[model samples]
Target: MAILSASDRDAAAYPIQSLFVPFPLVCFTLALATDIAFWQSGNVMWQNFSAWLLFAGLVFGALAIVAGLMDLLRPRTRPLRPPFLSSLLYLVILSLALANSLVHAGDGWTAVIPYGLALSAVTFFLCLVAAAVSARKYARLAWRI
Candidate 1:
């Protein structure tokens, strides 16, 4: 029985994209939480945190998409690949996340307050509440930073 290291792995043995699924979920969910915190406390730090989280989520989500495509393209994994609708859904979510990333990308420096909305790491809790509230829908959201 040969042992497989992380670098020796392939999609047929284990779906490459499976390794990446949890990351976008975690990052995007946390970004939503930080967005809420920034709104609730008027904290620039939370906004910064949310921006970084969104960036990470987008990166991971992109990787997952690439891995999924590679997996699906390979003949060995063809039969095991996810259905077309599910793949389309995944792409849709990634696009939404990309837009969400754009939402988080702006407004680090305050144009309104004039004091500059910046960062403060000491001012955060785990603060995972908004993940359950389920109100961060992209289509219905207003397009503002």
Candidate 2:
């Protein structure tokens, strides 16, 4: 009886609510790894992988940003600064890096891969820090609520 009841409760909570951190962390790490591989290998495979990773990162990052904004806009939710300016700056840098990577991928400009990868690494780190800070702030606000 207890086992059955526990299973029922678990089923009700199938989709865990706090999955925010893992998604971004995975995207950031994969993107960085692909970028680094492209930088080191100079292989077409790595270049392709990096491009896909960049696209995935952009999509996931955009979703995360939208979710955060929605949370901020929620009634009675705590006000967060959103780090919009910093995020935007990083996005611009990332976009440029991605563009460079794409352009140079076909032109035999192997050096551009590392440049883009390095920029992506820095941007990912910044994003991680921003997410941590935002999570902490949100936790506090959630506690108060």
Estimated TM-score per prediction? 0.62, 0.57
What would the per-residue lDDT of candidate 1 be over residues 1-145, giving only the tens digit for each residue? Answer: 9987744454325558868866877876676667667666887888778778867877887898889889877665554455555555556656666655555566653421221122211111111222222223322332432
Clashing pairs in 1: none
Q: Kindly list the per-residue Cα lDDT of model 2 for residues 95-125, writing each as its tens digit.
A: 6545644554554435446466666677577
Show model 2 residue runs off by greater than 4 Å. Answer: 1-25, 76-112, 142-145
The lDDT values for all models are 0.57, 0.56
Q: For model 1, what is the error of residue 70's alpha carbon versus the real structure, in angstroms, after optimal superposition?
A: 1.6
Each prediction's number of clashing residue pairs: 0, 0
Instruction: Identify the candidate with maximal TM-score.
Output: 1
Q: Residue 119 in candidate 2 has what lDDT?
A: 60
